[model samples]
Target: MATTTNSTVVANTSAPTQYPFLGLPYDIFHELCLYLAPKELLVLYRTNKTLYNLLKSADGKTGVDGKHLWKRVWQNSPDSAFPPCPPWMTEPQFVALCYDDYCQRCLRPNLLGAGQIWTARVRYCPECIKTQFTPRNPLEDFPKGPYLNEFINEPHLCVPITPLRVALGDRELVRDHFHTPDVARLCRAIIDASAGAGGATDLNEKRSSVMQQWRSQMTQCHEHAKLCHIWQKQRARRIRKQRLLAKRYRRENILSRVNALGYKQDVSCLGHRYQALQGPILAVFDKIDALTDDVIAPQVIAFFDERRTLREWYWHRLIIGVRLGYLTKALDEYRQAAPDELLPHPVDIATDPMLRPLFTLPMSANVPYPIFQGLLPEWIQTWRKRRDDLLLSMLTDDAPSLWSCMDSKSHKSHSSRSVTRSSASHPEGPAAIFQHFYCTSCENLISSAAATTHTCCYTFVENWRAEAWHAPKTDGKFPTTTSDILDSACAREFQGITGWSSSCLRPCAAVISDILITLGLNTKFNWSDVGKIEGMHLRCASCCADKTLLVMGWRRAVVHAFQEHQGVHLCWVSVPPAVSYKAQLVEHARHKLTKEETAKRTSWKCHHCRLPRAMDAYTKSRMDIHMRFTHCIFHPQQGRDYYAAPEGVQFLHPTILIAATELRSENLDAVFPEGEMFRNEKRVGFLSRVYVTNMS
Candidate 1:
């Protein structure tokens, strides 16, 4: 454990031990008991009947509101990993374990993440109850504790805290921890009860101040809660809208094929012709279609002769049946199998005179869209927007283009560097433009009259531009300057990039918008994992076929294809981690080249010259030179054609390209190292073309 103290037990003994609890709330006691490292909780329970009996109750509560005290203790208990428990622990041991709990997120733990110094106890679960330190644990990126093997030899146990017999006041503990008495803003309260100074004093005064501060913080939370609630509700509504669209597509697809059969030339198209017919007419068609030559239904054909009136009757009958819940089960099944929106719209049958009877079906008053009796205008708009964004993400490189545009000199990059003043004693006007621009993240001020784009600190560019610090020129047209978007909200037309939220552009922001837009269908995923598979830029999620999908690769074919087809968001299984696309391509190419090299080394025969030659030197150039100059065959014709005099040539696998790219990279590595080396297989093809010509 990373700590300054040296008094608490550092490791559990070889004998698997149990916990020893003195006092605890019933509800918390039960939870904490279970949270103990492992066997330690059982040991604690067996210590005495008073604590053991109290823990037996299932539905229990700590009578007083402890203000997250028990929760803290439970979290601090040894991590879920590590399989061993601790024995009875002192107050310092308890406090130490509590310090490591509650941290769930953050790529790596920094100085602030390990809160062990302020605590006195080291928390451990019953299982593997040595100091609850993780060594090389997956997902733990912090310098936690030295592994068991590296910590100390022979299963030793040392108290984790300083040598002390008493507790310390707040300030003294803080001083002991952070090496500063002013750990927090407050002073003159309790202190560390170590041998030097500090004891629990003026508790009442500190409590009052803390209470006031807590009240103020609670009030602030109350004020912001309303906005948070509104935003959350809006998000829910948006998600619901997307779901309805997906459902609509599913429903629509169900009856589409059934309806398409109306155009079927075969007289036996039952589903399409009878789809809109009401119950009686539907039954008549069903009976006519069902009966054999043995027993013909006379009424069926007679009614079909009076086409106009008969079709109207059929339509009305079918509509009435559907409206009266007769078809409810069928429609439900349709939803289950496919869905309405996926099928063609029911409106396709509305204009058909044969289907006119279906329009007569009465509407129910209770349904949400009872007024329209179907989808409304607003629903249509919502569906269209999602669908469009999906299509944009799939087909168009709009997402990637945004970043590309921002990167290009024509858009934003070169303009930032246009601040060329050229003189220090008396700089030009352009140099002054660089004065206000500084990176907010790193606090680095940019210098360069020609500098247009901010380097190393260009996040949230629009927000910076909208601020006052970016003062605009006096011209009415307005020169480059920052103006707070909030201040000039009414005057400026704004759109948030919101990369974290956008499905289409966010996933393929660079590749789709940059490479695909420039190259069309050629743009897609290109990855390799020969080495350092962990170092690749990946899309957090994607939008596909009326749903948003969370995946790993930026180029998700199904997602992009479906998003182009339908607009929506959905969840999906992520791509398997550690599979490197780039590495796969490189390895495959190398394997192919190695095979060709092996084959050439084994097989050497100049069949055209009717003589044996070294395959190693049988390159295109060497072979071609030897074929035409040294040994030429008799010709029948005299033109550019091979039969006109060219003796012969041999074919070779295009595997040599792999070697050329490998060679180019080693040379370029001096400047770019591994960065400029990121590439796809096409580079190999281009390099092979050059190598072929040069060697020939």
Candidate 2:
């Protein structure tokens, strides 16, 4: 039977082809089909006169062949991020072939640098030749802009690029006017006159000279901007290399340091090395010496003028640079311009009357200028001495104090901290009072570990270690205040807390420390606050009875209100004076009433529930203190050191986490895991692979 559909002949194979040309085993036909591209297969369909006659009669409804005509589209279309032809590019084959050549020849080697972060081995197809790509960018989308910022990076966040400031062309300095020597000389003259009281000449002549200098200088500045363009590109190239090398070498050096710190990055280990790179990213600009003697001097001169217009750009940017920040010889270098000759139109206007009236440098500079006009000299001398002391201290051969040294300790020694629960003197307290207490012996070890901390210790070993900080004193005009000593002590306390939290796997150190120093403490003590929290009117550790500070209730306002001000007044908020047009007249009329005048009454509410409550000011405050003492549910013991949601807080139950264990098992099976279900359900994970299950 002959069957035709539209313009195509349907091949209805009998047992095997009986005719001479069509005689082939079914397996052989399959093999031949495999060797043909889709287009070639279509061509094969038209080869025979019998087949063509059967297929060529109609082109109407047999659009399957028309679909087949798009054989090239099917063969060439890819679901890959990169393809033979990129849609961004009109020519696909050329781009694909070139990309393959680029990947094999150029980009792979370029990515090679410290720790293979710059380089990774690539799998390539020699025939097709293609580059590997990342999916961090969106494909087939409109350009990201406008309101798209919410979907992009944060405002001040930096990203890695070759740095455009380093890559611009010489023609970029359109506003620069200081390109020629003549223009520079004119700028210099204008800088000098504007810097001082204008050469004792007529004001109008000086003003004309100043404006002429500005225009000429602007031209040179614009021309010089082009010079910066070329140098900027070179500088940008330098910056790229510096960034790459610094990242590479720093990692190498850090790994070296970690190794010296007794760390070897095990291929099997996950975290510590990841954390090493998180330190202040060793600056990503060009090398420090790349600027050489010219870094501040010439760029400063070019950017600023005596009129402070161009110059203020440099000053303001320098301050922003300070905020972004680099180390400075002087701290005030950011906010104020220095008076060195490097600064535009260098002025020694100390003795001058007119100029001194308007401009003054910030106090960070200890240079007591007569332009400031009123300095006692001793205060300036004291500041200079302190600056010298700070510089000398930086250069001092100081081994890190004991707390700093403790940072590199073995993980086990730090992890086994004991939580000591003590009986409360008051019965009204939580069922348990817990403190992360150290053995006296362990504390003794900490004291002997560092001189700075030992100086504050009064123990036997510390009595000897205390000698390291003492110096023979001569009679002086003043004695250091105890307040200053307390301030220093407070900084060390925070430093200790910082060291303990991160390395000890305590992430929520701030909040935990707040509880320890405030409501849960044995005594009212901060290195700064020597006073007591256990007041009669205050909600404190000493007052709460069976309060049972649980992490669950701590988030509730009813519970947390107890920690604020005892039970008296829940909070005391300052109110601004009332604005009423008739308040003055009302006050006068009230005064006219004399002895029977009444005091103004104000309404108050409960801080915890926002419910209306009534009390006099004194009684209100007392009630607030009592409430905090009785109900503050936050505990010192709830440190964040685990992965699971803090036991009782059920705020978020995301779908991803719902029945996670079952999903995990399904995922393992999808990966073709070879295992049987254990009788003990807890023994289900890869982490628990070898553990025997106790089936009852």
Candidate 3:
């Protein structure tokens, strides 16, 4: 019937077939279909009619029964998520149940697993169940008489009440619920309509037997619902544990690689972060034809070591290049004025005033700079190409397989040969056919191969993991403060000083080690080891039960208490600060500079001017004023001087005022200090005429 429906659907469309894979020969087409998992096959089946007709045709072009093909395909699928198919269900129905979580009636994933109500064979969530079912009270349904009421409430009828099954003419199921009178009348009509089918001579016996069967069926269904509920919980828990174990294993493997290479634990190398680098590195590995770990480990270590200074140069070059290449008006002018063959050299970037500070040649003319400069143009062109490739691969999901490390011969030909010999005895491969499902809540494209969780349930677990850093929402609004969170019942019950739920109280090391794993922070560290989570309040393990102290020194008292009296052990509870510690450190440094020592007494004479001895070797504030007036320059300020020097002398500090003065001198082709003295030179000539008689 499905095949016929598919054929009719294709025949109705005037447009040509758009299905890509149906062009293959029947043997090849069937072989390709065998590679898809049950879930993927279901997607393939629903995609279009041509493929559907091909898959569903009786004893297909290859002379294989379609039903048997489906069974074999399901049997070969590597995902063991499905249970044994019930005796009443076919392979197609079982595949449908395994693949998706959307409720049959509501068309939403409200109930994770489709808990099919047994007698009706319809799956629904709790809310949908309530909406679809009409309660049937025996007393209310039948006529109002003592005999009828007694019969309705009889000991034989004492089973748990089930919802009325609404079957219309021709056995068509009706999903909508109706009021008592309409429902009771319809149910009575159906029961009475079926009385003749039993063919009993007496009316009571037939009615009694029918009621008995109805009660028995309802009781079995109610028991089955209970069992299904329990089974779903157990399955969900088992799958969750397996997922956590797999995640932990993957995390450990990445960490071990990082440790082996003695690499720093930066945001790029930590949990889930390595995904960004995975494709690029794998491509490189394939190009070199080397093992992934062996090539990648050394390459990363060498790259970081060589690029330490080179990276800084690249950043500088990038800034200079972009500013000169695009942002500057000079580039546009050059483009307009210059001939086609005579392009501007990159060395001309020094001419732009806005770029001069960064483009100074002599200051940064190291070995790395020249190398970085040579590579800059090409690198800039392709900087975003790899990232774009990864994005496209993720979207298309036809990414090149990373499983090429296995025996190459086996991967391509083993399955084909096995299928040709006997499709039934074909073995599954190490790699499973997986499809990516996007989770909107967590923004993770989860692969079905990596986990067995429903995308909906997995999202909640991800949200729970994030609760360590992120304050959870209550009634759609997130609490803005720690105090607001503490007002909740869970927080109030916590014995720790932070007063947060126990779920948030993970070991600081574990949380800080993952760094971006939980909160997905963009922070990067330069350290070579897993750094401690600093700027947090620590609770002493020994003293916390009796008293809480904010300082680590209180451990002495805990030790004394333990030795002298009883009960104590060394454990610590590290609490994250509400305010940023980095901000606090900056503020503290600023305060110390401003309050204690902003003006320092100095012997560094202003090189821009020749001042009187008493006025020279002045305080930092006076020198700044002297420079501002004499040279039109602002002097660089510093803290208090350690030692005093003679008046009108200098200590060699690289003063910005002096460098500017020197640069001005070089540009003007004249000497400074003398330039200031040249101003005094004219005054002294006039003073000699007034104060002394020149005999000559």
Candidate 4:
């Protein structure tokens, strides 16, 4: 065991010593040391005893002998304009004060550099600065005597004063502050020196001499501090310029590589010009390294591809919005021309299978209005037929007896006609009686046209900007290449209809039929027939518990049944009073005007009521009685409570009307023609697919 221990010790001693770059000749080492900055040299000096001895002078401190090395390093530095060391301080001291980034008191390192009180020749952290400094206000701290006079006259000689910048409102104010400990030490020194004096004259002379020497040192310090402040500002500006150049260099290199990969157009489409692509570019904008192709190529490809995918998605939505806008305007004109016709909402038309493809055309396609105008008539016919079929199916499943009666009446009407029509054009059934449907989600009574467009079932794209569509992860990492963001946004903004179909609608028809039976009216009554019946108001029995006497039309009664009574059963009863005249009057006054009547009319006014001061005109569709509940004038007298003045009314100009009509009828060739319809070479590949999948 003793032999083995000796052998182990010898093996440990035999291990070779490693000296890295330090083994270089003194001349080479000195040249390398000159290349390092003052901060780097300071770091090297503290690394080991060998380097400290090599760089230090014979006096065992970095003194005059080593001053030349520091001077060469300073000359080679990026900011060579740094002021030379003053005669009172050594080169090492000046370099450490200017470049060392640690608090002198606490010794804590700050990479951003500790705050310097150049007048005091010290660096301090924020905590040390607050605790060590005292505001130099003579009236607050000193007696009203010679000491106060000395402070007011020669503050620098009495104590080292540093200016503290303070922000006051819009301006910056500088107040003199001093180190409390330094002030106390200086006062103690002055007092101790004066104690040995024989008389007042000698003591005054001694004090004057000490004050003069201190004042000279402080004056030099103030002048050097000013130079240092200017050097710091210039250095900061240069560093900022270098960083900005590095950022531009990296951005240009990445964009060039992306352009080579055939994404120049995509980048332009989603770049800062439109403010579309920000995340990936901003992620690398502040980077300082010269990014290599291998390191940045994959990230650039992933970022641009993902951004391109998002841009395509946005373009799809944009095209859909534009098409929907046109369709809405066209539908409004159609309704104005033919008020009796029942057309589906523009949104529903956009979602139709045959029409949806037209809306999903590539972004480059410039489809004219005439094409949609030509197809609108047939689309409307198909929509009405489908709506009738859906209602018929609903009645068959829920109210077979009502369906049978309507079918028989329809067959009889068909036989009465001399020409036999196809089943697609069969006579309309009693399904029109159930034109109004109830939304279970929102509990609102809506017409057939509005049922499919209800917010409860459909999602609207509110944010049109592409940049807002998706955001980077909070931790600053972006997804590599994935559709999770796009899918989530599409799920919110382009959802398929969830509960707008006939099967999903609340059983409003059954409730209306029950109400009809209660009122002793035929269940086969159409909307117009029901509207023609005078004094047809029904009161909610459930609401009567509050003694409110809530009477409403059949539509509102259906809504109340669902909202207040859960729509399982109705608690409605007909009013027994013979007040048909009064009921008719109330219905007329409360009835909302048609779109055709309210389009541009500006002379509507209520005779019974006027605006405050009677200065403003009232052009709202309903009478003024509708706006005030306390008025209780639902049965407003026509021409007395409400009248339409002929003079103030306006209509579309004849020339504008003729132009619009001609534009609609004008037969321009299809923009893309027959075979080229969906083959725009510049169109994004995934756009049509994404649109169809999300919108359909």
Among all candidates shown, the one with the greatest lDDT? 4
Candidate 4 local lDDT, residue 98: 79
**lDDT (0-100) at residue 463 of candidate 3?**
31
Q: After superposition, how far is residue 261 of candidate 3 from its true place, in Å?
A: 8.8
Per residue, candidate 1 scores C-alpha lDDT tens digits across 501-586 of 12212222223232222212122233332122222212222222122112222233222323332322222222222222333343
Best-matching candidate per TM-score: 4
Candidate lDDT (C-alpha), each = 0.30, 0.27, 0.37, 0.54
Sorted by lDDT, highest first, which candidate order results?
Answer: 4, 3, 1, 2
Write the residue-wise lDDT of candidate 3 on 1-696 in tens digits. Answer: 232223323332443343355464444455566677777877877788765765676544434356645765666554344444454466566567645677777787854566555434456676677765664443455433333334464422423333444557768553434233323543584368445644433554555554556557556655555654554566678767776676556545544565676544332322243332344443432342223453345665554454334333333333443333332244334445543422222322232233344443433444344444454444323423432343334423322221112222222322222112222221122121123323333222234321221122211122322232221121111222232221121121211112101121111111121121111221233332113332222333333322222222111222222332232222333322421222233234345443433245444554432111211345656766766776667644443221232321111110110111223333432322322111112322111111100110
Candidate 2 wrongly placed segments (more than 4 Å): 1-81, 86-253, 261-281, 284-619, 629-696
Off by over 4 Å in 1: 1-382, 385-510, 516-585, 589-696
RMSD of each: 36.0, 41.7, 37.5, 20.4
The RMSD (Cα, Å) of candidate 3 is 37.5
Tens digits of per-residue lDDT, candidate 2, 1-696, equal 112332332233333333246775433443344455433444554588643432233322312233222223334322222122222222322223322323433444323221111111222333212122222222113132232243234211111111111225655322211112232344355445445453434443554455444445445544443443443356457658777776666445433433453323221121233421222332322233333231233332221222133223323322322321121122224214433211110111211233232223332433323423243233234433443443224212121210121111212222232132222221112212111111122211111112111112222222222322222122101112222222222222222111011111111112222333223243223434322321201112222224111111111211233233321212111111221112222223334332232111111222332101111111233434534564462331212211111112211110000011333443644332332222223432222211111110
Q: After superposition, how far is residue 475 of candidate 1 from its true place, in Å?
A: 73
Better of 2 and 4 by TM-score: 4
Per-model TM values vs. the true structure: 0.15, 0.15, 0.28, 0.60
lDDT of 4: 0.54
